[model samples]
Target: MTSRSAPDRLLSVLAAFDHAHPALTLTDISRRAGLTLTTAHRLVGELARWGALERDASGTYHVGLRLWELAALAPRGPALRQVALPYLEDLYEATHENVQLAVRDGGEVVYTEWLSGRSSVGVHIRVGARWPLHATGVGLALLAHGDPGFQEEYCAGPLASFTPYTITEPELLRRTLAEVRRSGVAVSDRQVTPDALSVAAPVRGPDGTVTAAVSVVVPHSGARVPALTPALRLAARGISRALGWHPPTPVPAEDT
Candidate 1:
């Protein structure tokens, strides 16, 4: 067997913790990281000293605040969230619905910010939660604006289904994406959950490429899709403008 490098071994110990396993014992880290107890102990000590991991009173370790501090510096992650937050807050105030901002990562959409409204539908999404591109309104907006080749490849995938309403067929998903592009909005009708629906619009960058998506989730039973579309699109455009995107100016007409 090939030997793992020092950096790989160190990263493995840190990677042992995830959304599912947020804390771990020394033995658990050693097992999950495929390292010896002694090696795991050494690495964990270094990481703790560097503030990359923190140990609890029970001797279990969790990812530390230092990592979050570093992650905040990423332009596509927390930086984008900082720029989009005011617009998200405004949308939340206007609709009192669950407002979210997400960016596409591979075949999944990683939610960067979420504001829960007092009377919003029950959604289990956290800031870092991820969902497949075919299941959520934000995901559909992003997928619809993605590169043509990548979109084609994603539409041919083994799409995972969350609720009965989730689009599982490739052809149907393709059609839905087309409609999203034509209408400048995407609707996830009880797709993620049977009781919740979402309306989403694309957020573009200065280069006119889709960088993120914004959405509002409401109860599916009485969802006002048409009513929510304008607000969602307006908020998305505001965020895009904040990120240096401007709608193209029309060319002047020639002499008649």
Candidate 2:
């Protein structure tokens, strides 16, 4: 096998930890990163000393708080979360459901913020979690506003299905996107999980381009799509305006 660069090797050590393996011993890191024991030890020490990784009392390493501080500086990460948090809170207060803000990263949506109410339905989502664009309301909202060429290409093939309701056919997905555009909202009906339903709306930037999406998830058994849609759209627009988006002013009819 070709030797990895120093930077690549170091990054692999950190990448060894994920949602499933949030903490690992030095030997575990070595095996997961495909490096020798000595190399893993050296890289892990360097990262721990630099505050990018933290070693617990059990000798297992996890991502450090310092990395979180750096992540906060990402424009599409914490920076956007800081702007949309208030509106998200308001939406949660109004519906007492699970409120989420997500941004599209390629063909997937990365959830940036989530607000859960006491009575909210159980949803298996956390900050930084990713889901395909065809399986969630927030994902659908972002996909509908994405570039037409990219949307067409994404709809072409290889769409993953999480549940029976997930849109796997290209033509049906195309129609769904068109409906999202016309209705100004996207509804995900048990696409991700059979018991969950979501309603989402696009959040625009200063240039009036959709840069993110916001949604509310509730139990599908007693879902109220009509009752929830208005609140979700209002919260999304509130966040978009906070991000400097101005609704296009209607042009007056020209005198004949």
Candidate 3:
């Protein structure tokens, strides 16, 4: 929960409905949030009244527009997505592939926006989707730019593999992260899905810290990694600039 008061229990109920389980019955929410049915009912009622949750005709609750509006205020969420949308659109237009924007939320990457192109490969990724640190291109880009301690802990993981190409080894994952940092971009070839490939570049903030990532996913067999890097990097830089990152001032020349 964002806060740790009695209301946190209710907020936790709201938090539990993400991309994976966008719609849940009261019982489902109660079990998932580890709250008793009575507690769940009470909290859900409060949140529904507050416009944070909405009950559908079938009695299942989904996240309400109110919460989505609140999440929009988060600088790392919709704020960033808004600044990046045009560039994201350009990338999608150029490649005719799936484009996405994501941020590091703890050890996972949460996709905030996605644009699917007509000819793109079939990918299960959706808005609000979450993926582990080592599984997808955007996830790897965020993980590679994260704090060292967190990176170490994540690398020492029982890494989940979505496909045979997923890097499940700690040492190998470390090396790959190093490469991504050095090259300023990441690529996942059939790592998350057998028929898809993704290339991602880190989006920086005003202070030059990596704040988000942008990526494009295409069909694995016909993907052109070499040609796609420039487009991805251009979009990343555009988003960073929109977020107020100015080019570093070049040092003055010495006296002649």
Candidate 4:
């Protein structure tokens, strides 16, 4: 293992536990983070004392509520989620489908909120689940509006395939992103799950930058993408306006 500075090593131990590996013993954490068991124990003790991690009765540790509370302060995470939630609720009431809100985190999308659909299509995605930027509709919407360098790096595959329709080819993925930009929305039809489809639109910030995305997931069979598109777009635009986005003024034809 490469030698990391003490602070870096400690932070790595904390980073090792995410949505995938939420529960870990000291040994598991040490191995996953490439840290010595003693170092893991020391760092874990400190984190536990500070309430960043919680130790279970079985001696496993998971992220604590305190950490979740701290993450709430991040404007791009829970803060945005809180503001968009009412509109998300309205969309869910309208469609009775799975509603999700997510933001770009590195080359992946981190889900901040999820509302279960009554039909229950076997999608197990949770509040903190992450998926590649090229596969999920929310991820695509966020990535399409991201910085050029970040977008280029993300499009360089190692793209994961969840279903047959997932865009694993770089060229196809590139085309799909371009389309998202042009249409101001994204549709992932059975890309993440074979039976489910998702339609997503970008949520903008005060400065008009895409900060997050909202999506509705429904069964792919007999799906009406056209009908869902308008609802999703309206929800996204409502959230964007709530964040203070205003369209630029149009000049009158007489002025020309």
Give all candidates' CA lDDT scores: 0.93, 0.92, 0.87, 0.88
Candidates 1 and 4: which is better by lDDT? 1
Instruction: Put down candidate 2 lDDT per residue, 15-103, tens digits, no spaces.
Output: 99999999999999999999999999999999999999999898889999999899889999999999999999899888889999999
Q: Flag regions of model 3 displaced more than 4 Å.
A: 1-5, 15-21, 24-42, 57-60, 249-256
Give candidate 2 misplaced runs (Cα > 4 Å). 251-256
Q: List ranges where model 4 is wrong by over 4 Å.
A: 1-3, 148-159, 169-171, 251-256
TM-score of 1: 0.95
Instruction: Tell me the lDDT of model 3 at 248.
Output: 60
What's the TM-score of every candidate structure? 0.95, 0.95, 0.85, 0.85
CA-only RMSD, every prediction: 3.3, 3.1, 4.6, 3.8
Name the lDDT value of residue 137 in candidate 4: 92
Model 4, residue 47: C-alpha shift (Å): 1.9
Count clashes in each candidate, considering only residues at least 3 apart in sequence or on different chains: 0, 0, 0, 0
Which 10 residues in a row give candidate 1 its minimum summed lDDT?
247-256
Candidate 3: C-alpha RMSD to true structure equals 4.6
CA displacement after TM-score superposition, residue 150 of candidate 4 (Å): 4.3
